[model samples]
Target: MKRQIVLFFALAMFSACNKSTKSNATQQPTLADYRVGEKWVWKYKGVTTQGEIRSEGEDTREIVSVDGELGMTIGTDTIPVADMVKPDESETPKYDWPLEVGKKWKFENSWTSQDGTKGTQSQDVEVLSFQEETVEAGTFMAYKIQYKGTISNSRGYSADTDEVWWYAPEVKNFIKLTQTQEDFFYEEELIEYSKPQ
Candidate 1:
């Protein structure tokens, strides 16, 4: 009877441990979790070709609606769902879901500016690594992605751009982004994030 009792308790403890492990494995975020009312605040700085500060300020993006896709309003700009990720209407998704290290993809798109300036851009993106990052918003496990691309305009001018982005799945958006184009530099980091009640 004593041996049987010890065996029964050991089995129960093993079952409990298995259940806890399963729960922790399934807690990671996915693309389907991005929903409306999500908000992100960022602090940004921009530098010009002459190495002078062009702009520095705060910006906020809030998801006001999600129909077939998600839509966010940033400052006075209401970016439609379709325009958020892939501005050029490329078939490749702006963010390849289920991010993994060493993953790589290439996409291209052409666009005409509001002022009628036409251009084409292509980007080669790679997932560099995944690690925990602590920004002003909080600490999160994020995927670090690198983007190397080029843009050419009808005016016979072209520029190369490099961008690094830290995307936290829990936030359903990027927590930090650093970009360099020609002699211009820009950086934005998340200060806060919230989900709608």
Candidate 2:
């Protein structure tokens, strides 16, 4: 009888362990919860290749509209929702949805600057960790992601780039970003944020 009781207790403990593992696995955040009117303000600083400070200022983006996706207004540019957050099998996702730790992907993109300069970029991104971080905006849980890759410009400038981003699912936007390239380095951190009433 004692042996049977011990066996039953062991089975019960194993069942509890299984339940706990499943619960933790299902706690990941989803991207569909972001709402309209959500806004984030950031302070940015830049350093030139010559080690000279170039520009430093505050920039803000506000969610002006949301239907199937989110649209943000930054300065005089009104970025379409689709351009900001679309995922596809063939193209790099602007922001990977349903974020999870240890997830990784590769992306490539080409763009032209208003001054007629063209560039191509390819990068591999990985979710490094998830933890609580405090910033000017506030303390919150965030995902830290790292991106490493190379970029080449039509001006015959090619360099390797490394970037890190901190994203908070609750805000539906990245709270901080740091990018380093051969020619320059830039960093931005969220100073303020607001949610729709």
Candidate 3:
């Protein structure tokens, strides 16, 4: 259960979300863009090609105050808005800023699971389009970004992964993500979002 919880948060961190369609939107958000009362909710599920359900549930994040600093909740952690707004620190970051259609880049990451098995992910990422996308939560202009890559672990487990993600700038987050890796498949989508107007 703990491992699943961690993976859930990791997925959310790696895949960002939001709902307004500003056709020409660019520029990564800053800490100032967050508000304490803002909240985001998503529904996610993971399964195998064999029809086995690996996981299913909902995830939520909300901005709040912590020690006078703005904090965002994820699983059991409350991360500072300042930290959340910074560009990802990975050498081949998951996201390249000022995202635009036709933009392409490399994305990579290395991780050690709780069992101490090391793994690496290497992928080619492309922003395919900027257009309207609709999910259960609502409709917004979003970027259709795709990733293709391979993931391997020290234990000899490896799989090719292909993913498509839709990021909505008005909501400042990803509205949907679908991933396929070998026999495993995973999807997550935004279901609710609210903030003080």
On a 0 to 100 scale, what is the lDDT of residue 176 in model 1? 80
Q: Looking at model 1, which ten-residue stretch has the lowest summed lDDT?
A: 11-20
lDDT of residue 2 for candidate 2? 17
lDDT of 3 at 156: 89
Q: Which stretch of 10 consecutive residues in model 3 shows the poorest summed lDDT?
A: 12-21
TM-score for candidate 2: 0.74
lDDT tens digits, residue span 1-197, model 3: 32342354344443353322365546677777788898989898888899889888998888899989998887788877776666776668877766778989998877776677888888899999989999999998888999899888887888898988888888888888888889888888999989878
Clash count for candidate 3 is 8
Q: Which candidate is the best by lDDT?
A: 3
- Each model's total of backbone clashes: 0, 0, 8
TM value for model 1: 0.69
Measured with C-alpha atoms, the lDDT of residue 161 in candidate 1 is 74
Q: Report the lDDT of model 1 for residue 145.
A: 83
TM-score against native, each model: 0.69, 0.74, 0.87
lDDT per residue as tens, model 1, 84-116: 333223355344544567878885656665456
Pairs of residues clashing in candidate 1: none
- Candidate 1 error regions (>4 Å): 1-36, 65-71, 77-91
Q: All candidates' lDDT scores?
A: 0.62, 0.62, 0.78
Runs with alpha carbons beyond 4 Å of true place in candidate 3? 1-25, 88-91, 114-116
